[model samples]
Structures are given as structure tokens and as C-alpha cells.
Target: MSTAPKTSIIPREVDALKACTQGATYEGVIMPEDLPRLAAAVVSIQREMTGKVRFFRDESNYRMVTAELHTVVSVQCQRCLSALDYQLRAEMDLAIVVSEGQLESLPKEFEGWLLDESGSADLYEAIEEELLLALPIVSYHDQADCSASGQYSTGDFEEPLAEKKNPFAVLGDLKLAGKADSTDKESE
Candidate 1:
């Protein structure tokens, strides 16, 4: 393993998991402001993401990486339609692969982590992907925190809808009448 760079932030030029020795873990912090891609998804970041990447060989002897991350940001809550602080956490397990063609060789248990021909993936981008996946598809505040929570519903549920005649009912009646006419002709 190459000597780790002396910084709390991940080094851009370094190959994260590849640089770590087997069974070793590399730790770093990522400031959201430094990542435009992530920053675009949030109103503001409350804390820097602290994460660790562990490198190891799995049972299949495939080179592997596991990244664990945690951070906080502000986003518009769907429930209250206001800015709310949200904690973001993510864990990713990946099998390092030089090319997509190598994906076929790895066990189905692991997600393939493809890199450039140089055998390196951008540490920041990989972590960002994990963080992105951690975001809620539809974020909502707790019922108590929501402004419109109690307005639409009583403690009881919605009442059963009133039954109404179908617009096609007349067509069924017409068909029955036509059938009766055909039966009379047959009888004749």
C-alpha cells in the first residue's frame, strides 16, 4: 500500500481502495461545497461527510472495497414544503474491476466497480454515488411536523364512496333487448 497522504480530505489523484493494503482502512472527510454534483441536490450542507474505505480480498479472492459514509444536509420536505435537515448515510460494497468485461468473472454477490484502463476510480465520485443513492425518493416530515397532516383526514378514514350507475349500463340493456328480438325471430 502506498503511504497515505497527510490530509483529512481524500486525495483526488489517489486510487482509494487500490492504495490501501489488504485489511487496511482509509478514512477521510468530504466537504459538500467542494462537490458541485452533490451540492446541487441539497439546499445546504450541515456537516462534512466522514467516510472510510476498506480494501480486502473476498472469499473468491476478488479485490473488494467497502465504503461507509455519513453526513447531513438540508432539503425541501415534501410533507411541510419547508427546508428540513436530513441525515445521510450510505454503505457500498464493490468488486474492483479494470473493465466492464471483467464483471462477468466476479461473483454475483458483489457489485462491479469499473475503473479506467489505469485501474483507478475517482474516490470522490464513487462516494458521491453512494450518497446519492442514500437520498430519499420522497422525503417527508413526521406527521407531527407536517403542516397539512391533520387537515384532510379525521381520526377515521375516508367514507366509502357513493355507488353510481355506470355510463355503459344503457348499452347492456340495449344488448339484452337485441337478444330478446333475436330469440323471438328464432321462435317464429
Candidate 2:
């Protein structure tokens, strides 16, 4: 079956009211370079990310957006310090708010997106934030895939540690030996 060609360039910013009124839906591929914040977090992006964002007025008359994003990115495995491919998916429901005051009034079901001074919301920023929140705080390959998986420990090692000597004990021994030598010299 034929599918409609999706736009590759989504506008970075959009007028929230206009989009909501028109019920605009944008489906597209966002280039890796286009998301600087996300790029900085990962080692590299495997390919262009695909996403769909719908803007509409909710039942409560709140201008809202729902975004679904998917991508594969490369990040360093914290365990082995090697590159690992990570599958990232993010979804967000945000209500467009013009000010912080409006945020408090936002329904529990929706998060607030404070509009810029220009009275527009930044779709790119919102998308990036969602992806960032979705990322693993610390990434690691599965034990089968990780080179350093079994090398870390918080308990005693399998092999016993060498016996440790205290410096003060050695000094006490020297003092005793010196006293012996002094006594011997006085006898002489």
C-alpha cells in the first residue's frame, strides 16, 4: 500500500493557538544534527529519528500537544566504556501555557509548556526534553554483551589480600632494638 510522503523539516517553532485551532499534525524525520542537546548526550545517532506530533484543543479547552518519538542512538556502556546501541522512544502530553501562573492551573493529566515571549512554543525544545527524560540515567550492555560485566565488585575479592603491617609496630620494634644496643654499650 502506498503511504503519504512525510515532511522531513518540521518547523522549529509554532504558534500554539493557530496549530491547536487547525488541529495540525506533523510527521517527519528529524536529523541528528538538528537536535544538539540530544546529540551531546549520546555518542552518536544511528539514523534520523522519526516522530509525529499532534496539536489540538483538549476536552477542557486547553491547547495541548502529544508527541511520539523514536530513534536508535549510540552511547557508551558505563561498564565497559564501549559503544552500545540504545533504542530510545519518548512520548509526551503537554499543554501550552503562556506563563508560570497558568502552569499551576494545568490539569494533572497534562504537563505545561510555557510559551516564549514571542507567543510561540518551540517544538524542537519540547521534543529534545522528552528524549532527554527518556534516556537511561546510566547505560550498560547486557552481561552477555559487556566486556567488563563480571569484573566489578563491592565485597571482598576471591583471593585473600596480603597481610597489612602497621607503621607504629615497626617503629616500636626499632625502639626496643635501640634500647638493647644502648644497654649493651653501657655494659661495655
- Give per-model CA RMSD: 7.9, 3.5
lDDT score, candidate 1, position 80: 65
Q: Write the per-residue lDDT of candidate 1 for residues 1-188, one digit (tens) a residue.
A: 89977657755455634554447677888877766777888777788888888878777777788889999988888766788889989998888888777988777777888877776667778788888888888887788887868665546877789999999999999999999999999999
Best by lDDT: 2
Clashing residue pairs, backbone N/CA/C < 3 A, model 1:
none
Q: What C-alpha lDDT do the candidate models reach, one value each?
A: 0.79, 0.88
Residues 1-188, candidate 2: write the lDDT tens digits. Answer: 99987567667888877899999998887888889999999999998888999999888899889989999999999999999999999998988888788989877877888886566877888899999999999999998889997788747768878888987998999999999999999999
Worst 10 residues of 1 by lDDT: 13-22
Task: Please state the error at residue 94 of candidate 1 in Å.
Answer: 0.7
Model 1 spans > 4 angstroms off: 1-7, 16-24, 154-188
Whole-model lDDT for model 1 versus the true structure?
0.79
lDDT for residue 42 in candidate 2, whole number 0-100: 96
